[model samples]
Target: MSGEVADPKPGKAQRRRLSRSLVIIALSIIAGYLIIQFVGQIDWGQVYRSFGHVSWWQVLILVGVLVLRQTLNAVPLATFVPGLGLNHSLQNDVAANVAGTVTPPPGDVVVRIAMFNSWNVNPVDGMAGVTMNMLNFYAVRLLAPVVGLVLFTVAGLERHRVGWALLCALGAVVLMLILAMVLRAEDWADRLGRGAALQAQRFKASADPDKWSAAVNKFREQMSDGFTQRSTISMLALLAMVAVDSMILLLALRFVGVPASALSIVLVIGTFFSAYPLTAMPLFGFGVLDAVLTAAFVEESGLHYEPIIIAGLAIWRAITILGPLLAGAVTILVWRRRSGSNLNLWGSKDTAPTLSEA
Candidate 1:
């Protein structure tokens, strides 16, 4: 026993759990306080009245736009897996959207990967496709702010907000530069992975540098292959999807009697581009997203119809978040019944079907 190290204490694990619980409680309290404040400021009667202004035909159009957006979303996946049908792709997208509502960054990707595995798709190819799609998605979002900045300058309005647009443009450029380095610079991805692993180790996480490096290199290679194979079509589809989705939001505002103008359109797109990162939050960023969008509507668009803005936001959330969540749940249930597989969406034993079964 001379050189034996002392066993780790059970109390340390319990203490870590307690610390996590306390942090969660503190965050919950803060969020609850904010929500109470937001609710107190709103007039429910006006919000209800605003909803009556939106016509049933307009609601149909909004639903159609959302359907089209979802359809376009599956294009990149179909490109990645040539044999995959559009219906399956749509189901996967819905499943991803559902998972993303509950989890943070890359939750959609996690669900997609699991779905791909069940469908007998190669994991590397699946990851490559998802990464390429996400890259294009964010690229378009970042670029939109720049376009809005140009539009604003041409319109001779909101010159003061140019700095914010420029900042977002710079962020986009930085992201592109990092992507280029990962794909084109030999060993750069590996080095970045090793550095990340080193940082993780400092936080008491177990990470093998060599393994991380290898994975990064593989990811880069797959990305390179995907780009070479389907970049043009995928990028086009992604751009179109973003544009249509933004239009959906604009239409929502219009339905609620928010007068549409060139400046308003530019502001709407720009505001969405800026607040896009909020989607990484839980429940598809429910309260946080509404607050950000409401602020943007008032400040960016100079709209003072607080009730209309709140109502429009509710419609937007219904179309984008709640609808997909419901559809995804149905899809999962159908898959379970048909496959008779004991699949778990959350972390548990994976019941992904094999190639033969799929």
Candidate 2:
């Protein structure tokens, strides 16, 4: 044998990690390319000039609004997670927001479970809370377009968009009905779960229908009480967050010198709400949504306003992305100090139970 033994073949977990890394790298390259293309099409000089119009006081006001928005965002999670105070929920929400922004899927999930573990929360309960928050959030997002369409009609802007909004409303209704069925009856939950597993099996051969059925039943049981009692509060909190988000975008547009004569507030709100669903996409629909919004504003307000539209969008994006990142850093540090322990971001010894364990 050679003096240096050949490196042992990578294990299954190592292979999985390598595969995920490759996928992330590929996605990053694609997103970067799209960003470059988007930037190339915009008039940066005009956008910069538009940005100069924003005063220091206006920036301060925007920051204040952003803080409130972040606070409201933590409410739903706190409402759902029994014994998790607003302060801890804020920490958890902020940290997970940061992780979700920088990494994909399980990144946020890991941060959430780890934080719950540090706080001595039951793992199953934490997961159930997180799941409810997501479901409620998405349900509200789907309904947003309907609200927008109503506003559009009220403003007498246009009626041609009605068809699309109707489709979105229908989807929301279907989603709500299915969720209600799952929560109201264990049999329905089991059937739904097994059906989902069968569909999943198309992609992953190892998907077990019986396990999925058991998991869904457990999830329904875990969530029913909180969903019945606290769901209204959760929904309201999310709606308030959406309202604040829209307000920030509107303020950015005005501060950047986009006049109402060019684009009315009603139109702005309608378009922004309609586009809100795009946030479900990767990186919160970074390049794609930005481009879409800019194009919509330009089409409505004329191409002359494109530069200011881009500038306004830039401000909104920066606050929403950066505010959470900075806050999350502080929250993570506080969590470390309060817990008096270094928690492993990836499943620590004290980490709460995972879905499989549940």
Candidate 3:
């Protein structure tokens, strides 16, 4: 009798590993290329001189602002994840910031999920906390332009690029409305889960429809309960965090001897915030953001201080990106040592279990 052949399962894990390696290699190549491009555009001597102009007091203020910004960013996590202390939240935020800088979209989320899992948090709860915090952060970012426009008009300043700002604000509103509907309506969440499961199945991806549906339902329930809790404080903290970051940017410009007006500063900050989604892919949009911000500042201020602008941006990135990255690396090392474990960057290997196993 002819026997039916069983599909090989060992090949599946091998394929996954191979695909992951390929992705890592591709990302590394892209990052290296972007770094080279950025370096080639800078004037090293001018940048070095600009650094000398910044006072120690300014550096201290920048450091303080960065710390406050990070602390504020952690509030939403503490709010969503009951019993998650501020220290844990800050640690998670810093670590995610480091990972997200190097990885592509949703990299921060992956790192946070892995960290939470290692901390013994329930998977669904961890996801809920991260999702809520992300939604709050984006909502504030999208709405800021509209708020800035209103303030600018009241302040009697020229509203440059108002049209683009309005369009982005409207889009943000629409997205927020859709997210609200999805979170509030269990049926919508269920439909989304079912559609996702169907798509995964069609792609021959490993997924369980029942599990997906259950997870979605659980997420909705958690979100609903969490929102009903004292969430206003968390939302406000998120807004404050954005404001603090903008202030830091404004200070950076001042340190560069830029005679930018308050209105110009607001608009420039708004532009930077709006351009985040575009520039976020390459190391937290390192080179791309610097270029965009420099162009915007030049266009708005009508100044040609290219070297100074570049230097200011370099300082800003140093404090925001490099500082956090170093802190996060140290945090990881300390945690591993304290736990007496040799976990990888994302956390213990078992923390992020395979999809099939999950």
Give stretches of model 3 more than 4 Å off: 1-44, 100-120, 226-232, 260-281, 346-358
Listed in order, each prediction's TM-score against the native is 0.76, 0.85, 0.77
The candidate that wins on TM-score is 2
Identify the candidate with maximal lDDT: 2
- Whole-structure CA lDDT of model 2: 0.80
Cα lDDT tens digits for candidate 2, 196-234: 999999999999999999999998987777465687898
Worst 10 residues of 2 by lDDT: 346-355
Q: Which pairs of residues clash in candidate 3, taking residues 3 or more apart in a chain or in different chains?
A: none
Candidate 3 TM-score, C-alpha based: 0.77
Q: Could you tell me the lDDT of residue 312 within candidate 1?
A: 85
Ranking by TM-score: 2, 3, 1
Residue 133 Cα positional deviation in candidate 1, in Å, after optimal superposition? 2.8
lDDT of 3: 0.69
Per lDDT, what order, best first?
2, 1, 3
- Write model 1 residue lDDT over 1-358, tens digit each, in one string: 6999755554465467557656755664467347535544767799899999889999899988988988888887777655566787788878877766554334466567667766767756766666766776666556655666665566665633567667767876787778778887658998988998998898857898888888788878766665645756765786677667778888998898888752277777656655665555544456676676776576544535767877887898788867778888888778767756565554322333332333
After TM-score superposition, what is the CA distance of residue 253 in candidate 2 from its true location, in Å?
Answer: 1.2
RMSD of each: 6.1, 4.4, 6.0
